[model samples]
Target: MNQLPTAPPVATAQVPPHLVDSTSRYVESGLRGAANTVRAYAGDWKRFNAWCTLNHLSALPASVEALAGFLTELADAGKKVATIQRHAAAITKAHELAGHDSPTADKKIKVLLKGIAREKKTRIKQAAAFTLATFKRTIQSMDVTTPTGLRNRALLLLGFTGAFRRSELEALNLEDLAFDEEGLIISLGKSKTNQLGQAEEKAIFYSPDSAVCPIRSLQAWLRVLGRTEGPIFVSLRKNQQLTARRMTTKYINLITQQYLGSGYTAHSLRASFVTVSKLNGADDSKVMNQTKHKTSAMIRRYTRLDNVRQHNSAKELGL
Candidate 1:
């Protein structure tokens, strides 16, 4: 009988050190992911590494079972489901890059997303829409005689009139503003955009007319404040010199909180602008274009039909 020959012993495989280093460098340089996204993933990976180290487990080249265990640990520690999902997402992305498939990726992501939705439903208090009347009240309540107060008022007007996000407002430089025959044009450098999620790199121009109330308020503010150059809004110290330093997102939040009390957030200003423009018969597509919103779904989040306009429409329709 022709019996099968004895099977040869398997040899241990070894990957070269230089090959590993080269592969890492290639990933660091040439990965198609955005820089910010990579940074976030790196941060997540570090946290995972730390957790695994504390528990005497290996974090590198994590397996589906290890990931599931980690998520279970997170759940036990009362960590938010969103946070767990983020960690899972980072691991999944890393594994995909390493040409490996993760069995838990879809399941973990789905569970986390469901948890996020449930949490959101529990916190369903949306921001109340801002109105022209409420805006005037807020401005009037401010003690604009003080330099800081005056600057804040101007900032508020700019934020509302230009539909500026906190980041966009903070990034504005004095050179970005242009005085032309049409009106005042403030150049916006960055804001949240659907096209890129956030931090869009292009500059957009926002025009505020002297004839309009919001624009007129801004013009009056610019005239009273005498701030035409340098960083448009500088931090005002007790000495009253406009510091070379720029304003921050936190300052925007504080200022809005101070003026509007609890329900009025800085983002409400931008939303109000979009809502008012839509109620005034401005085209949604044009408004979306100006706001740099790539989708109608997101534009709806920022734009709502004005209550007064809705009432008037109802009356006209005999409803």
Candidate 2:
């Protein structure tokens, strides 16, 4: 709703001697997070500020009672636990920027959130992950002769094997890739998880099957691209002419849904990577190496083995 500036002029408000140091610390760490997170904070804070205005309450220096009530309202409005939690974080960021003590630290706010999470189930809907069989089948159905088709094939294959987020797929440039004997190496400067812009690389090995191979598909697309350096994926005109404009993250979602059926989201590419890898007996460490997740817990979370019969040790035990 609101796009608050990531950085603002320092608040020159008077503060007590005891709080001055803590206030400075908060200011230094104000609103630091991943790009998507920061944007969410800005929008959520704007919505909170609007709500406070309607209720004639001060948004800045929010009281514990006010913060609790706002959070409760979000829950009542059917917002998921994750959304409510993010909203609270946004409010905290707002307070930090203003150099005010965040009411979110209060026990009342914390307990209120706990109660809301319990009352409303905390399980948010994850994207539906497809089997590798389905992935290959979908890839086979595409007509890569067209420029648009080639682009989609490259993105989908690369995204799945590399375990790339939609944002990362959209951010890919020609220079971000390096080809060698083994396969292609994708260099990522920044990503949803790797927000610090650390130098991260994901190795994509050549697939024995050239039809659904990421490296081969990418190379084929590049040959048609005829450009030394530029955005890898771009919008194409009706006549199959590629434009300088880059493909939007939303387009990535549409392309996935277009090929993989309406049931799957763009994230299915990455989620399926984890699910299929784990299904194939890949350990958490190996999956983490590809996904770049800091913890094994996250890799487990991304795994979509809904059927209890599959990957279960129950059947292996002596009955």
Candidate 3:
């Protein structure tokens, strides 16, 4: 009888140790929160780890005293109170993930944070809103002849009208846009408020004037781009040719600053929307629909700087 042919040995695939380690870190980071939040927490944890390594201490189960000392050193180094607080929160999260009690809750750590806040007089510097006049001037300054100009004009107009955060603006894709008789509808896949990947829609109504209309600007940009899919905003080469890569939030800030001058950031678009809308008599709930703000408190905060004088009871009292 003929013997059966010997079976060929099957090859076993082997994954490198480093890749496994990296994948674990990626998964852990994903579990924590949004990509930006994960990046920030990772950075904070790295700093804490470095400090521990320099002082010959264990970072995994850092002692309360050690954490307190770290905060003290950060304060002494002139780190912002908010920065220190974020660092402490990162450390606490790490310990919790490792199945250890959070050292950040120690009385000493709390006391140190309180002292730093008191010393620093921690006040958040809000981004100044771009008034309608300033926004119009900036738009007029843009040269829509070139691809970069068209993209920038569209970005600024859409960002302002939609009240989008920098990340939201940058995250936009061609698929997110839908045009109707009224104007355009943008579907936000995820945002700071909708972290669970829920779908949210923002409508951009058409303007009778073509000069300052976001919908028209966006249409012009898409027509020039000549593509049906992919990132809405991308980097432009020195020759003004569009690149396939998507732009970052940092770039958005730089672009806004470039056109609007100093003291304005990417957030200024959102703030300007809130301020202008409130000044135009749009109430909190109405603004919330455009901004996707979960609470009236945040809406008030955005409009507070501009509306303080207008909304004050003192004005009604003729003081």
Q: Across residues 102-198, which tens digit of lDDT does each residue of candidate 3 receive?
A: 8887787788888889999977568898778889988987888999999999999999999999999889999999998878999998777787788
lDDT score of residue 141 within candidate 2 = 89
Candidate models: Cα lDDT each = 0.64, 0.86, 0.83
Candidate 1 stretches greater than 4 Å from native: 1-53, 56-104, 119-128, 194-229, 304-319
Whole-model lDDT for model 1 versus the true structure? 0.64
Q: In candidate 1, what are the lDDT values of residues 1-319, reduced to their tens digit?
A: 0111112222224546547655555554443255445556777777777777777775656655666678777766866656666677776666555555654555764674566547545433345567777777777677766667768877887777677777777777767766655556665543444323443322233334323344555556566547667676778778776567888777787888788877777777788878877777777787775666777777787775646555365667765
Ranking by lDDT: 2, 3, 1
Residue 7 lDDT, candidate 2, scale 0-100:
38
**Ranking by TM-score, best first?**
2, 3, 1
What is the Å distance of residue 216 in model 1 from its true position?
5.0
Error of 3 at 218 (Å): 1.0
lDDT of 1 at 205: 35
Clash count for each candidate, listed in order shown: 0, 0, 0
Per-candidate alpha-carbon RMSD to the true structure: 10.4, 4.4, 9.7
- Per-residue CA lDDT of model 2 for 178-286, tens digit only, reads 9999888889988877766889999999888899899989988988888989899989999999899998888899999999989999999999999999999999999
Stretches of candidate 2 above 4 Å error? 5-30
The global Cα lDDT (0 to 1) of model 2 is 0.86
